[model samples]
Target: MSLVYSTETGRITPEKEQAQRPKGDGIVRIQRETKGRKGKGVCIVTGLDLDDKALKLVAAALKKVCGCGGAVKNGTIEIQGDNRDKIKDYLVKQGHTVKFSGG
Candidate 1:
């Protein structure tokens, strides 16, 4: 049971809480994916336990360091091209435990 409407306020609606991201194991993984983009490789970074804003910031930094364009999707950062080595260096410099996953 909840109050849908109130006389004092027109159409009282409940606040929508932000969904929480699942905690990670403190290890960031960088993997290369090329299945969907017609052989265009995209570096998929995962295992970063960060909120949306922080995740975007990290993605931006990675893109800048790699000198390419990228986007943050589903709590994972996708950097254009195979920039694993560059990303690994940057993440390591940021003090994050980075691992290269898959072939």
Candidate 2:
């Protein structure tokens, strides 16, 4: 009998790369409020690693999972609406260590 095992070569496919990226530590607070000219309560995801592309990907994934509109700016993901629990749960399921911040 022969056994086959895959080693950690850090080689991941595009789909897998998107699915398996490690989310940084800390509780990302989701803030829904109309700030400045944007007259809409936007869900904001903060406390992410300071990486441009990573932030964008995280925001996109969260938006897809929550079925809402969002964008990444100033190192925060501004999702539309208050889906804090949903986003946190989704991130955790996606192999990310998540924490909840704010009330």
Candidate 3:
């Protein structure tokens, strides 16, 4: 066991992050979450094995395709709206294994 969080910086280093994501058979899961959004919806994309920079790049492409505003936080990509099907197709065409969850 080793310390991943740097007390001086008050954050976890890249190598030891990603502890929040639950992993399984290696497929990305895109789900629509509206629980805390005041009735609006946002697509939560998870299970991507990408570092911050790479994830941002992918998020940019998805945002372009969806034509909406979003952000990447805590290793997950949040796209604005219920664009799960569209995103699934785009990711498949881009060679990423993906799955959809939620309504």
Q: Top TM-score: which candidate number?
A: 1
Best by lDDT: 1
TM-score list, all predictions: 0.80, 0.61, 0.77
lDDT by residue for model 2 (13-32), tens: 44333323346555555555
Candidate 3 weakest ten by summed lDDT: 15-24
Instruction: Note the Cα lDDT for every prediction shown.
Output: 0.95, 0.71, 0.89
- Residue-level lDDT for 71 in candidate 1: 96
Better of 1 and 2 by TM-score: 1
lDDT of 3 by residue, 26-100 (tens): 788999999989999999999888878999999999999999999999889999998998899999998889998
Ranking by lDDT: 1, 3, 2
Question: Residue 80 of candidate 1: its Cα lDDT?
Answer: 99
Q: Which residue pairs overlap in candidate 3's backbone?
A: none
Candidate 2 global TM-score: 0.61
Whole-model lDDT, model 3: 0.89
